[model samples]
Target chain A: GESVGLHLPTLSVQEGDNSIINCAYSNSASDYFIWYKQESGKGPQFIIDIRSNMDKRQGQRVTVLLNKTVKHLSLQIAATQPGDSAVYFCAESGPSGYSTLTFGKGTMLLVSP
Target chain B: EAGVAQSPRYKIIEKRQSVAFWCNPISGHATLYWYQQILGQGPKLLIQFQNNGVVDDSQLPKDRFSAERLKGVDSTLKIQPAKLEDSAVYLCASSLAWTQFYNEQFFGPGTRLTVL
Candidate 1:
């Protein structure tokens, strides 16, 4: 199975600042990708997603940028808050649909006041 | 709409003991998924169900793990003779049909099992 890994295991950002987390996937066949945020003792929550057909997508205060040419994906959070601190994961899926989401190792985002 | 619900928020048992976890997806969801998350690692898929039928279980260790979604609305996962390594957070998620790319999964709080 192909692997998806984050450029950093942990990231710290100051409150009110923008934060960027990067992920790299090895499978070019992947056509869809999503970002999830997992709070302590809770399941992952959907953040944003992008399809291969597009290079970027935006959600409320969150943005996902995909560079298919490099097989890289990133999540950007605007106005980081302590409440946003959590482990973030980037998952990839092929045209097979949403049932087969392959996850990355994950990055812990710590927003400090 | 109510989010996915899971039971036994936390569990502790000795090695070789058996345990089960339950999950109820959001109303009208047709796709269900089970994943195992070890400490310091991301969640890994264990099984997936589409309606009342299984769509994938390739990563599941059938020798020790078994899951069922009897009526396709709720599901249960069982681990028999659990090992120390089996201690992790088991998460349940639900999505819409595969034909829709707008399908985004909603996850439950998860069951954290500790093997002592």
Candidate 2:
């Protein structure tokens, strides 16, 4: 089933703490996985990506871990800030990188100062 | 560099009416895509194009939906006889290339469509 309503899983963390968001994918053949951050009234912004060959990739303040065996993915944000409050989505590319991306039910991350 | 662009930030229409949305990809991006985002959900790919050529549209409701990218730069998505379930945000995204290697996709501020 798809999440088409206003209710979504929410995670709240205090500023300066580490926040972790998790996602589970169905397609085992997906070639690429990406994490996106979407703020209120704004489009989703790319945070980081990891190829199937690699299990971990890191960016400035974000890290993405891929577990092909369990078909799971997770995003970690260090030193969370107020600006990090937003909805986070994990997307996986279909068979090929050129094809469609299957997104998961997003998790809302709220940071309080 | 400029990011993807879309127009008609918001729209409200009655069921059975028609509507269209436009998108302009970032410079030199050959892959353009349209996605539908329902409330609290991730974006769902509707159509994909590579330099004016259709690559994928499996999820598109062909009966009432149509799209085009004649010059391979800009594109449009149209829906006729809209249904209440058609209410969602239309998002446009582009990537430099859609090859074996994965490239980052840049998305535009979507057009929010409300069907009553």
Candidate 3:
């Protein structure tokens, strides 16, 4: 059984501060991990992704760190803004290409301006 | 390029009622997926389709849920005798290549279904 889960259900951060959201997975076979942001009524938008071969990957203002040894993943947002206030989710897909991603219970990131 | 398209934007029905959702993926995308997102929870994979064929549906509740992708482009998901727990948003997404390593998934405005 493959399942991805998150640590926090909600996080509040002051504007311009850094925020980190954590996740844990039960499947070691997962090879690819992705972070997504969902606003009030929008679909999950891709933020960044990291493969099992790497420990960290950086995107525009977001970073995804993967720890295969512990089966954990984390998403970091720098200089969090009001627009960044939303629910963030971490998803993982197994090594088999074209596999469905198992998503964790999302964490609501509230940025207080 | 346009993203995935889904409708109607909102649906409300009573328990044990039947409801259907439609999705049109991005042009030229080979893979399409359906997901169910309950309030305050992450999206769960319901089904995956590689073109008109099924790729993965292990998590889908086959007893009351059924989906089809005709002509390998657009798809429809139907639920029969829907339960109150079935109340959630149905999201549809598509990727250009199914086997590519870094293919980004483009999503649609999900159909929010409310079962009373």
Best candidate according to lDDT = 2
Candidate 2 per-residue C-alpha lDDT over B1-116 given as tens digits, one digit per residue, 9 for 90 to 100 = 88888999888999999999999999999999999999989999999999999999999999999999999999999999899999999999999988977889899989899999
Error at B45, model 1, angstroms: 0.6
Model 2 CA lDDT for position A86:
88
User: Comparing to the true complex, what docking class would candidate 1 get?
Assistant: acceptable
> Could you tell me the lDDT of residue A69 within candidate 2?
99
What number of clashing residue pairs does each candidate have, in the order they appear? 0, 0, 0
Deviation from native of the Cα of residue B104 in model 3, angstroms: 2.1
Clashing pairs in 2: none
* lDDT of every model, 2 decimals: 0.88, 0.91, 0.87
Q: Write the per-residue lDDT of candidate 3 for residues B1-116, one digit (tens) a residue.
A: 78889999889999999999999999999999999988777888899999899998998999999999989999999999899999988999999888847578888979999899
**Could you report the DockQ of all the candidates, in the order they appear?**
0.44, 0.62, 0.42
**Which window of ten consecutive residues has the lowest lDDT sum in model 1 chain B?**
B96-105
User: Of the pair 1 and 2, which is ahead by TM-score?
Assistant: 2
- Could you say which candidate leads in TM-score? 2
Candidate 1's displacement at residue A102, Å, is 0.5
lDDT of 3 by residue, A1-113 (tens): 11122344889999999999999977898878889888877888988888889999998888888888888899999999999988888888877656678888788898899
DockQ of 1: 0.44
TM-score against native, each model = 0.93, 0.96, 0.93
lDDT of 2 by residue, A44-110 (tens): 8999999999999989989999999999999999999999988899999867776578889999998
Clash pairs, candidate 1, are none
Best by DockQ: 2
